[model samples]
Target: MTALQSRIEGHILTPTGFVLGVLTLDAQGRIADISGTPVATAAVRDSGAPIVLPGFIDLHVHGGAGHDIMEGGDAALHVATLHARHGTTSLLATTMTAPQSDLDAAFAAMGPLCKQRAPNAARVLGVHLEGPYISEARLGAQPPFARPASFDEIHRLHAMAPIRLITLAPEVGGNHALIAQLVAEGFKVQLGHTTGSYEQGVAAMRCGATGFTHLFNAMSALHHREPGMVGAALAHAEFAEVIPDLLHVHPGAIHTALRAIPKLYCVTDSTSAAGMPDGDYKLGRHTVTKCMGGVRLADGTLAGSVLSMDQALRNLVDTLGLDLADASRRVSTYAADHMGLQDRGRLAAGAWGDVVVLNRDLALQAVLVEGHAVRLN
Candidate 1:
């Protein structure tokens, strides 16, 4: 039997701006229509005139809600549910620097689950292989398992499942060629966790590496004389992901990047500690302690974040003074554009009915993935 269509009225946010109207969704979960005039026949599902924005698309989230992606299966599902409550409708299931076998197991478990989008849970777009192929000098919280990129290993991982993004150091031997190959294979090559020089980063960009992972965190710094990866990323106007918890990058630096790189977008880079009380959490093989608004390794080096997407949105607006529309682009549209997902990151007639509803206070009121409202409480 066909389910009833839903009509929701709100101040709908688009790429350009907001439109006050009624949005109708068909049972198949794609948007049917959006009209300023209310349809009298359709049943109203939401009518409070909440601020409805396109569901956030996180490209670099590691884990959340006490479940790391390395645990796979139920952990992935749990993380998805947890982030959905905080208004993330879709996210890449990100992995950490770990053994090849361990990373393979994580991807193996998530591949089937990605095929099956759990109801009301944040949809798993694909796998983001963050490490085991990154730089050694700027490893940060990544374990010693990091290595130079290899085509055979890359091919093996891609054969395991669809790898959406891979982070590698451009200066690594044979990596420039690897970046070109990955980009040709429909993968988004992101430079990160590297001690590569500015000229090396620029060379990688020319070779089709389109993004930088967690800009300025794992990559090289911007020296006045020689701006390393940071300078190259800013100079080329490539898409760069940033952890906006106000801890990873300073607000002043974020403002500078925003002015310099128009494609700069926000990511949580959140760990299993996210949505959990301050305590010990696992980021891959290493145990991280969450405390005092930050997660850190035993040596006090910064780990992944405890930030939620909703909180990142608030930080961009309340802390950084970005307008609502610009902040929306950072959290949603930019990531979608980078991932080549045209059907998402905007509320259009043919797009999936994914939305995050917030009250005037910018608190998350509800989240809808494929027109199904997720349970917030």
Candidate 2:
């Protein structure tokens, strides 16, 4: 008989959206068998309450705890670890708009970190470049000096490293051709930080913009007659990323969006101030303050958020009254599916053994990455 490596006996969540009892993880860090009947094994572990769900994936996160990914070096990896402990098993270290040299340096630095196979490092799924192509009118927290997207600039950045996803303003100069070129290069383009009209946004979507970054935060607001970028986002159900801290977007808007968008994912949009005391921090070149439960600028513009995916999941179920099955999809399954990630978001035979065990109160009890238990409460 083959030796058991680790077995988690609890309510298992599969990517196709179902919870069931299953014996997970065989000896080689892969799921071996999943059956309705529980099996006896030497490597069994009990999750105890709530449910054992797939590990959350955050395709859009700048930083967490007290570290920003733009800070680079081991600090970025350290921040990734902080979020991993909070239930994110896979994430893309996002960057803000910066000068060309700084942006290039950040991307170059991330290459080795992305390639490293370290236990503590959350699986880095490549970089999410959130600017240098966004509109100045809806720049929000992005630096104003960075050059906007040009076809040549986009190609240069793409050649620097494997940029999996990028966020830009549809109406920005040169964005139309840049978007088409990026799509041809196999990059996932997302629209964000824009004051584009509904028609411009629709044009972007048609040109291969497959997603929205932090919906309702940095884009034009929805108007009845004009129906700005927000309207375009809500009108199309295929692509949306909502920061469900109940801060970046209000609870009411989130509910409305959940109904409107066929495919929606949750992101923290968290800043360096996360997991720390209410205080000041830096997001690229701009200074941000964390107060109450939200982060903002001196002028009271919402900077990012201080939320984690575990808390976001709880808020979805408790505040929004979504079931575990649906809420799990927002943070795990939907986000994974959105990013075209095939193996890490589900619990099934041959899928990566990334699991999160949460208790009744929605607190993370433990987390398993690649069949190895990493975080325990």
Over 1-377, each residue of candidate 1 has an lDDT whose tens digit, in order, gives 12333877777775545667878888788889877743221122234567778899998878888999998667888899899999899999899988888988888888876886787689988888897787888899998888878777767877766789999898876787777777887889989999998999999988898899999898889998989999998889559999999999999999999999888998999999999999999999999999999999999999989999999999988899987778888999899999999989888888998888887667998788888888898
lDDT for model 1: 0.85
Question: Which consecutive 10 residues in model 1 have the weakest lDDT in total?
Answer: 37-46
Best by TM-score: 1
Over 4 Å off in model 1, which ranges? 1-5, 37-48
Pairs in steric clash, model 2: none
Clashing pairs in 1: none
lDDT of each: 0.85, 0.79
TM-scores of all predicted structures: 0.94, 0.92
lDDT of 2 by residue, 1-377 (tens): 11234776566666544444765687667788666633222112233434678888988888877888777666567767878889888888888888877777777777776775457546777889898788887888887854567666666766665678899887877787678878887889999999899999899998989899998888888999989889999997486899988867789999899889987889998889988898999887788999999888899988888898899999998899888778888888888887787777777788777788876677888777677676442
What TM-score does prediction 1 earn?
Answer: 0.94
Off by over 4 Å in 2: 1-5, 16-20, 37-50
